[model samples]
Target chain A: MSKAEIKSPLPGMFYRRPSPDSAPFKNDGDSVSAADVIGVVEVMKSFHEVTAGIDGKAIRFLVDDADAVMAGQALAEVEA
Target chain B: MVVRVLNPGLSTTVQDLGRPGYFHLGIPIGGAMDRLALRAANLIVGNDEGAAGLEAVFVGPQLEFTRDALIAVTGADMPIKLDGEEKPSWTALKVRAGQVLSFGFLQTGARIYIAIAGGIDVPLALGSRSTYPIGALGGFKGRAIAKDDELPVGNAAGGREGRSIPEALRRRPGMPAELRVLPGLYWHRVTEETHRNFFDDQWKVAPEADRMGYRFRGGRPLQFVERDQPFGAGSDPSNIVDSCYPYGSIQVPGGTEPIILHRDAVSGGGYFMVGTVVSADMDLIGQLQPNTPTRFVKVDMDGALKARADRAALLDRIRSVFA
Candidate 1:
């Protein structure tokens, strides 16, 4: 098994869920794929989705919810 | 010649000086956030100062040019690479046909401008090629440029290769950018303490900074002068009868974070404006990174006008250096 990281494409605040009241996009042990959205990065008031980019058996978030992040900052790690 | 978009980087858009004279109808003056950078890039490529060009925020687009042409990049310190060959930024360079141009991660500032010789030949809407995405109005299809799009380019007007702006001419904000404000019509609404605190405390650019407005945080909440609710305004003391938002007006909603309207600001809103940032510093605001520390400097009417004149002189100097 190998672990892949999900990185933010742009800098700003990162959110695990679509909205404040919604469930997180992924849990610590959730399975993910290249097309799966792991979180959203809010840059300059615009929201952009961040995909996992790799198929994995389990995912672990590296950054806390609503935390400030930079471009290419690792957001999560997924084990394949 | 034509330019092909290999990858449309985040929020890539065609913009010039923007369409004015229509904000009354709810359309904004939507254009490049860093107008000075756009103008500098265009001048380096020998295009009109306000020629339509690409404005990329943080991430720059990968573009493939169809023919040899001069191109210049300005604003953010995004490394310019042509077909794996690194090139100097802020200087005009010649690219051969089929050569691809790309950029590295943003090193400084928030946005970058790419001015091709003769400019991007997008159809103008309301006298501009700027994209007003919310209105679905101008620019390359009235929206952000998408991948695989072939954008037309005009013939170069004799731009010289290697033309570059001087180091002093390449403008970007210093650490802890200072934005000067002129207290406005509703400035009296805030209590005396709030007024002092607004300028006394240092604030950080919030993540909500954008073309429309920049929200500032890390300051004390505003305290309004207690009074009976004004009619048509909400119960919040910060509420007001909808009034025009001047280009740079600083509005505080619910007396919390302060939001300074920019080029694409709404025509009017229910929030009260405490002041307006001077025109000279608006470009600096555009280049600021989110979370950058900032302070508000109070300016009188004379100070504001002098700052405007100083800005004009700076532009004049830039124009003459290249002209």
Candidate 2:
């Protein structure tokens, strides 16, 4: 297995969950597929989905929820 | 010429100088966030200063032109692309009948203005093509452009290619952008400490910044001066009897985060405003990237008028030079 990083295409506050009250799009340590939504980056009030680009497992969140992130910043890591 | 939206990108809408005289009716001006940039793009392409153009944020739209046309891209530092070839921004370029126009990722600012030889031919609602999306009024059926949507372009108005706006005429966000503010009538509501700290702190533009308003964070929470809860004013210390919100008014909803209402500002709101950003500095706010640092500089009536005159002079310069 190998580790891969998921990066955000847009600069904004990264969110683990779709909404404050909802469960996260993907849980920490969950197995993920290439197109699985891991989080969202809210840019200037608009939410854009961030997806895992590779099949992986044991996903570990790198950035905390609601933390400001720059473009191309790594959001999470996954074991492939 | 009609252009087909091949990919509508993030958020692209048609806008002009905006519809005024309707703010009292709860319709905001709702034009391009950066009016100067919009005008520059239009001017560079030989269109009317108030011509309707495409305003894209973060990303740029891909459009295939059905007929030859001249175009100009301005505002953000995004590289323009025509049929996959790189083109310079703020310079008028010609696109063949089949050429597709696109843009690269934003390098500095947040919005880009795309002006064609002729203006976007969307029907005007209440005298303008600016989109007021919240109200479902004006511009390309009153919403953001969508993929596969065919946008009508006005007849060509004899714009020449290769015309460009000079570098000095372009406006960009500053290193720690400064916004001049005029304390509003409600400035008396906040404590003395808040008055000093509000201007003292360097605030960051929150992720929630948008056309409606720009929110700021990392500022100290405010303390309101004790006062009897006037009738109709809510219980929250920051709440006031709903009052007309002036464009650029800085409202503290819960005495915490400050939101500066912009072009699409609501006509009335319950929050208390500490001050309003001077009109001259308002356009630059639209170019600020999220998380960018900003400082509020206090200004009085004389200063505000002087700044307005200076801004108008700059606009006049752009007009004359382009003309």
Candidate 3:
């Protein structure tokens, strides 16, 4: 088994869900594949998708939802 | 020549120097938010200083060149890639037909400018090719670009590739920008404490900022001098009789948040303007990102003129680099 960390490409507010009223894109123990949108980083009022680059089972998020993230910050961990 | 938009990331629009002399007709001088970057992009590609180019916010668009072209990217530190290979910004580069250009995440600044040789060949409106999205006036169909849109490019005017801007001229992100302002037109209405605080405290740019204006928070709530409400004036303490809003006017709607109007702002409004951002620092406002700390510095008319002269000199220095 191997684990990989998802990183944010830009500095902004990280959101687990697509919107405030919607369910999160992925959760702990959920399966994801490369290019599966795991979250979004909202910056300059623009929303950019944060995609999972490796096929894996979601482990746990490293940062809380709606937290401010820096460029290249680790967002979540997944087990492959 | 033509370039096809593959992915219109965020908001991408074509703009030039902008149309002036039409505010009397309620037309805003909609153009590139950062004129300095626009000029840099054009100069790198051997185009006129006011040549039309694409302005991308945050993320940049992916485009496929249909013919050999020379291009330069400027402003923000958004990473550029040609067919997945990294490319340097602020430098002119040659692109072959069928080659795709894409952008990675923005590393610094909030906007990026892409200038191709001979500029983007869109029909001009009102003596300028700048886009006025509110009224759908100019640029490509008078709106932000969409995927699959094929933009016409003009014939190259002898632009050379590999020319780069010196590092000293580039704007570094997170550097606290000191913007010079000329106080006037209802500035006396605010309490002295609030006026002092405006220049003394650090203000963070609000997330709602855009081309129209850059709003600021984290500053002390400004206090207005008590006065009888004039007829037609709104009940808000910050309301004023309808008046013209000059470009870069800083208005406080409710005395809590201050919005500095930009190139795309309305010509007039009914808000109390505390100060006008000097023209020399207008480009700095375009680079401001959400949550960035900014400080306003008060300057007199003489100081403002001096700043403008200093900026012109800097631009000349850059122009002389390739001359």
Candidate 1 CAPRI level: medium
Q: Write the per-residue lDDT of candidate 1 for residues B22-89, one digit (tens) a residue.
A: 98999998888889899999999999999999999879999999899899999988789999899999
RMSD of 1: 2.5
The better-scoring model by TM-score among 1 and 3 is: 3
| Residue B298, model 1, lDDT | 98
Candidate 1 per-residue lDDT over residues A1-80, each given as its tens digit: 77888888787899999999999999999999899999998877679998988999789999999998877688999898
- Give TM-score values for chain A, per-prediction: 0.95, 0.95, 0.94
Return the lDDT, model 1, position B122.
Answer: 89
- Give the alpha carbon lDDT tens digit for every residue of B101-180 in model 2: 98766778888999988899999899999998888899999999999999999987888889888899887779899999
Comparing 1 with 3 on DockQ, the higher-scoring candidate is 1
Q: Which portions of model 3 show Cα errors greater than 4 Å?
A: A7-11, A17-29, A33-37, A40-54, A70-73, B171-174
Best by lDDT: 2
Rank by TM-score, highest first: 3, 2, 1
Model 1, residue pairs in steric clash:
none
Off by over 4 Å in 1: A1-6, A17-36, A54-62, A76-80
Runs of candidate 2 exceeding 4 Å displacement: A1-7, A17-34, A53-64, A72-80
B257: Cα error in model 3, Å: 1.5
Write down the lDDT that model 3 would get: 0.89
Candidate 3 lDDT at B159 equals 89
Per-model TM against the reference: 0.91, 0.92, 0.93
